[model samples]
Structure formats: structure tokens, C-alpha cells
Target: MLEDLLLQGAQPNYADNIRAIAARWEALIPPARLGDLESGDLQAGIVSILESGEVTDDVILTIAGDLASLSWWRGPPLRDDHRARLNALTRARLTRLADSLEMAPRKLPRSQLRRSHVLLVGNLLDPLHSPSGGAIDYAAALASDTAVSRVEIVHSGEVLPAMRTYIEARLGGFPASRGVALVSTRDNPDFLADILSRGPCTFHVWCEPALSPAISLVSRLGPTLMFTCADEAPVQFADVYWYFQSEAHIEKVWKAHAAPQEFIDRYVRILALPSPEPRPLEPMSRASIGLPEDAFVIATVGNRLGVEMDEAYITGIELALRSQPKAVWMVVGGLPDYLLGAFEQVLGDRFLHVPFSRELDRLMTTVDLFANPFRAGGGNSANIAVGAGAAVLSLSRGDVSSLVPDSFIASDPEEYFRYLGFLMDSPELLAAVKAEQGQHNARMRDQGLFLKEIQGLVRLAADRYEARGCGAPLSTTVFAPLTRLAQAG
Candidate 1:
């Protein structure tokens, strides 16, 4: 069955067969990088898989995870037909899942609700040690509401050392009577189900589509909120869709899935998760970093440079440097050798590659302009740059990139380059932009404001769940907004 599905132009109706083929191919050639999907053959295979099957919960989820990893801005684009088919499949699968989860309406009085005990489920790289954005978001959620009596974190994978320290600190910080624990479920569905059965708690799934099967099941237990965190589609099980990006951008994402206007209006809400406060650091000079003291420095900082920094991004830097004599490019993160070689071949000493540093805050002080490549992630770095008083330049697409002020955000490649040139040429204008961004950054980082908003959204989600009479299903055919004709089959 797998072989027949893998054969060129062969279409399969069973989703389980597509899942088998995908699993086999993944084992045969494990993707080393996100850009692996950029290969023409791989893209064709993915499109074929999407077109072949009746989207099952597992297959659609796996495909969504793969699509999320692609550098959509710099791509061998998926055809319109394939995109439409994928969307149709996604809507159909979600509708069926919603129907299956529906239960008889039974109202549980508000007094019986265990709203004080909050449960957060997701994949954290290292909540205790490494301060990844997801980790910070999780921590912030725990600290956001002092009114809550208990916080339970059910995460996948092994609990790292840092997580232990965080748990200790959280326990110490809260009243001795309160409870706090971070348990690793090891991605076991039964274990997760057991945890969910413990109490009537508000659940938040801060995960990518890959983990949807395990985490999405939370909706069956209680009021479930899924933080999109810039992941592609909304999880079908989530009652409320929480996002960090602008409302307009969130609407745009839902619209692409062909969501009905009513579905979006009722479920979508924007809330900025709190980021760690930037600590004070002594400023570093250009010469200290081995750059010309008087040179105009333009830098892009990120952890996944290999994935985000493509050939076009490099070419753009090269063009900007060649055109502006005093302009120098400094990249502060890891990159593949091929990309590094491209940088060296074009601009010799003018390009400075700094390994990921602890003194990133100090280094930001020296930069004149922080240029963000057109990519999916990097909201934290961009916010840091803005707070550090660097004029941030980005294309107005991506969840992270769209956070910049309108004047600095470019609509297209031409505008991006134009904005960069204008900023480089006029120091006065650059300084003004930086000041504007700093103000915006300050507002975004307001811990109190974020906490207030998050608390309200949680209440809102709980209210909606209660209003729906507890276990009664939320949406049925609402997800099949634009695919009703196809869904009729």
C-alpha cells in the first residue's frame, strides 16, 4: 500500500496509507534542516500526499508541521491547486474531529469549577536552563495570575536541569500552601489523558501541529486554549485561539484556512506573552567587536541563521554594503558553511560573524540598524533590537517581523532595500525611527498589561466553555466554511 501511494501520480484514499508512506520516507531520509522541503522532488511528494488522502487527524497534522518548517518567504512555492486541496483536507478533518468529540449538553455550575488550578501543556526545549521564547511564555503564564491557587505543567520530552531550578524558584516564590509541578509525560497519550482526568482545570496547549494529537485531546477535558505562537493552522480542538501577532495577521491566517467569518469572530483573540526583562549590560564599542570604529553597522541576530538567512538575504546585505561604502554587516548566530562561504566571497572583512553570545545586550548597543530577514520567527530578537534603540528594518509579513512600526516595516523587497538605504543615508531619520520603536517596545514589554490581558482571555475562554454547557461540542461544520460542496461528499 505504501509503495503504491509513493509511486508517481498514484492517488490513495486511505489516510493511514499516506501516514505509512510519510513515516517510511521520513525514516529513509530524515530532514536535517527546515529547507529540506525546498527540494523539488520533496515538494512534489508532499503535494502528492496531500492530494491523495482523505485527511486523517495524524496525516494532516504531520503535513502541517512540515509546512510550518518551510521558509515560506523564500521558497519553491506550492501550487495554488495543492494549497487549496490541503486547506480543504484540513477543514474536513477538523470538522470530523469536532463531531467525534461532541458530548451531551450538561451544565456544571460555576461554583464547582476548578478554575484556580491551571494546566499548561507543550514542548519546551529547556524551561529551567535555556530561556527559549516558549519557556519564557510558560513561566510568564505561571506568574501572570496571582489569583490562581495551583499551576500544573505537563510537557513532553525529558525535563532538563533548568526546569528543576525553575520549579524550585516557583515553589519558593509562591505561598507555601500553593502547589506547583512540572511533569514530563514523555509524549505518552495515555499518561497525558490520566493527567487531564485529574481535575476541571483551564488547559493551554502551547505546541506546534506535530504534537496536536497528544495535546489537542485536552479540549475533551475542559476549556482549552491553543496558543498558535505563529504555527500555521489553528488546532481543531482549541476553543479559543490565542496568538502573539497582530489581530489582522491572525485574521489573515484563519482566512487562508477558509474559516467562516463567524468562527473567526467568536474564537480569535490576540495576546502578547510576557518576555524576560532585559538586564542592564555595559556597552561595547565597534572596535571591541573587531569592526571599524566609525563604520555604520547593520546586523541580523538569530539562533537559526541557516534556516532563516537564505541566498536572497545574503544578496541583499551584499548589495547594501556595496552601495553604501561605510555600511558593515554583522551576523550574530550560527550559519551553515555554504551561507558563511557566500558571505566571505562577497564581503571580506566587512562581514563579521559573532557566535551566539551572552553579551548580546551589550553588542546591540553598538549596532546602528538591526535588519530582520523575511522569515517566520525572531520576535524576541527583533523586540530586543528595538529596546536597545536600534532602528529595526523588516518586511511586513511574518508574526515577528510585523511587530515593527509601520514606517520601518517594508511592504516588499524593493521597499525593504529602499528603507535600508534611507536609514543608512540619513542618521537623523534612523535615530527618530529607533526612538519610535523603543516606545513601541516598551509598551509591548509591559508585564502588568500582558498579565491583565492573559487573565482576561483565560476567563473569556472559560466563560465560553461554560456558556456552551460544559461538555457539549463547540464547532461542527463551521470549519468547512469554503469547502461545503467538497465536504458534502
Candidate 2:
């Protein structure tokens, strides 16, 4: 029924049809079955609607939100063509929305005013979720900085009891004068805008579908930075764009979006946030996790292992384990039933599946090698594995895994497998890799240095904004220095 409505495109009752399709989609698809649907048909349907030229902004927003949700829940598309088309269409709609709005000229901050406060806007600020972890870490880092006076997080979701407690504990670790607060507006864009307007602070926007309504407003408020999280293309309205992937990847996204060269040169910046500090954990033994103490443990950790785990990754693990009788596979994250069944059928007693846990640090202590699959995400987990003193082996791809040292990154799947075999066969080589990883982590985890870099960037942005002249159109000229600064970092 949904497909039929979508295929019909703009009908006499197009709005009603769209609403009905949304209702049915929500009713039929639960969270676990997000990946079960055939996205090709859905993508085609969405494209049809987009090209029909009769869709309203509200319906366009709905389609954009749905696409984002699918991307997040189902992982990145295996192929880029569909995603590219969808992004282009979505970008066009958003551009139209922005142009249609009669937005007031952006107000620049007073030169004498110190840029001490920062407002982080996002869909959810839950500390437990893997996607929100980077935002939380960024907030924590800002709070810890002496120069920053306050950190205000405006989120549009529920702050559950557990999440609030965790946030309190995490942010409370900083100085008492830092003044960190989480405000829940429950999807109220006007209220969110009011909060932003009330202060002269820098805004950091985390990319999420729920925050779609506020994007136009937020972009015009002071010096706004968009953290794309390596999931979507950078929204054009942001003054500064932050991404976890390499600069090359940023260029590719901008080119795909057909962004002007000047805009790309000025707004795009790589995320240079400090690596997370290793959390202290109680000693965990192999027996505690139901693994053999004598077996060599090779583990992979991620939040969405079901989406990330392909046949090749699973089969590689199976072959590796079969070749070495003493090898064991420990997967620490959520997995679909099919994947869980495959591991169970192949490895049986040798397979250890641990659900997403707070004790990942402890689990890493028991592992001999951290095997990272070739996927777009999982940089955070890979970094955690590195910080925990475990040797990480991953492909030399962009995303967070690029943070891994060059020596340990595999150029291809064959090299990845060969490296895995070599590490498993040689304990000394693995130990050396772990030592090098420790040195890399030490450099990356320098909070003081990282904080200084952030402060400098903020000042640069402020300077550029001021140079644009009062009530004048935003200039691309001032952004050149930022490009140099980002490259240097």
C-alpha cells in the first residue's frame, strides 16, 4: 500500500496519502526490523515524490527525516549512487526551504565579549548510545577547559533517569565553575531558537533528523558549527562544518553536493577533537566473560554490528578461527539474529557475544587483538580498543578508523587477512603494535593541547565573522585562513 501511494507520486490527495504512508511505515517497521526493508524501492519512491514538484516543505522534511533514520538504522549503503541521488534531492529541497525563508541578517558578537559559552544542539544527548558518545565527549572536553565559562546542551529528546545520572557524573567531574546544563525542549523549535537567541555563544549542531526543523534558524544564529558525524553531507548553512573522516572524504561530499568551491574551501574542517581518555575499569578475566583463558582472543566491538558485519567479515573470522584451534572470537555489541546464529553455528563454544556494555574497557583488557571490520563507522570503538592498550587491525579507510596508526592499517582485504594471520601467529609482533598504538594514543589524548586547538579555532571563526562587516553578506574571503588552520591541524 505504501509503495503504491509512493509510486503514484503527486495525486489529488497527495498530502493525505503521504501522511497515511508515514503512519503505516511507523506501524509496520519496528526498530529491530529497520534493516529488513528493501531500500531500493523506498529510495525510488522518494525520488519520484521529490521530482513530482508538488511536495510541500513539511512533506519534504518528513521524507528527509525518514531517509536519515534509514541510513542510521541500516548503516551506510553498500553503494554510493543511491545515497548520492538521495542526498542531491534532499539538498535541493533544503536549499529551496532556506531561500523561501525571510531570515533576518545574522548578528555578529561584540568584539569585547568573550566567547565563553557554547550551545550544543542535537536530537538526543543520551550518554549511553554510541552515536551520541562523541557529542558527549566534546561537551565534557569543553566543560573541562578553563577558558570556557558554560556549556549548554539543548536536546529534543527525553533524558531518562539513567542518562541524566550518567551525564551528571560525567560532567560533574570537571570544575564546579564550568556550569554545564542539559535542557530538554521536546522538539520545540521556537523554544530552542529562543534559547539560542538569549545568549551570544557559539553554536555546535550535531546532525540528526529530529533537529531538521531548527536547522535554518540555528544556521543564522552567531557562529554555527555543524558536526556531520561522518554520516551525512554538511548542511550548507553552517559557518563551519565538522566531520570525523579525512579531508579527501569532505571534498568528495562537497563535490557530490555541487557546492561552490569557495564554500567548500572556507566552511569544511576536519574534526580534531581529543581522543577519549581511557576509563579505569576493574580487572576482568576470560572466565568472567565465558571465554577460555588459554585461547587467543580476537574481538570486534561496535554498536551496530548487524549492519557492519558482512559475509566476508564473518567468514574471515571463521576461517581464521578454524586455522587456529586456540583462537576465540568475542563480539561486543548488538547483532541481528542471523549474525548471532551464524557465529553460534560456526564457532559454538569458542564464540563469545557480549551485548553493548559500560564495561567495554574491562573487556578490552582480556582481548589479545582488536579486529576492526572494513566499514564506515566504528571509529570510536576502534579508538577505545587502542586506548585500552589492545592492538587494532583495520583497513586504511576514512571515518574514525583513520585515527589508527598507518603501520597497523591494511591496504586491502587480503592484506587485512594476512595481517590478522601474522598477528595471530606471532605474539611478539602484536606486542610491538600495541606499544606503538600506546604512543599514538598518548599524543592524541592530550586534553590540554586539544583544548588549546579548539579555543584557537573558535577565535579564528569569531575573527572571520567580524571581518565580514556588520550587516554585510557573508564573505567567502575570511574562510581561507580557516582552511589553512584545519589543514595544519
Best by TM-score: 2
Best by lDDT: 2
The true-versus-predicted C-alpha distance at residue 16 of model 1, in Å, is 26
Residue-level lDDT for 90 in candidate 2: 52
Count of clashes in candidate 2 = 0
Please write out the lDDT profile of model 1 over residues 1-489, one tens digit for every residue.
333333322221223444564565565433542233444465555655555544445655566555433423223344444554565555555544544654565454443243444445455555412233455455555554555555666666665666555555445466633446565666554665566465566676655343355443455556666666443555355567766566677677667755456546655544355566556767788788798988999989876666566667777878999998888899988766667787778788889999667667778888999899877567767777777778888877765665666777888888888889999999899889988888777777777777677667677767877765575543432333434533552
Residue 286, model 2, lDDT? 78
- TM-score of each model, in listed order: 0.80, 0.81
For model 2 the TM-score comes to 0.81
Error of 2 at 292 (Å): 1.7
Instruction: Report residue 429 deviation for candidate 2 (angstroms).
Output: 1.5
lDDT of 2 by residue, 11-123 (tens): 22134544565575555444333333334466655555544555555555566566554444553442355555555455444544443545455556544224445555555
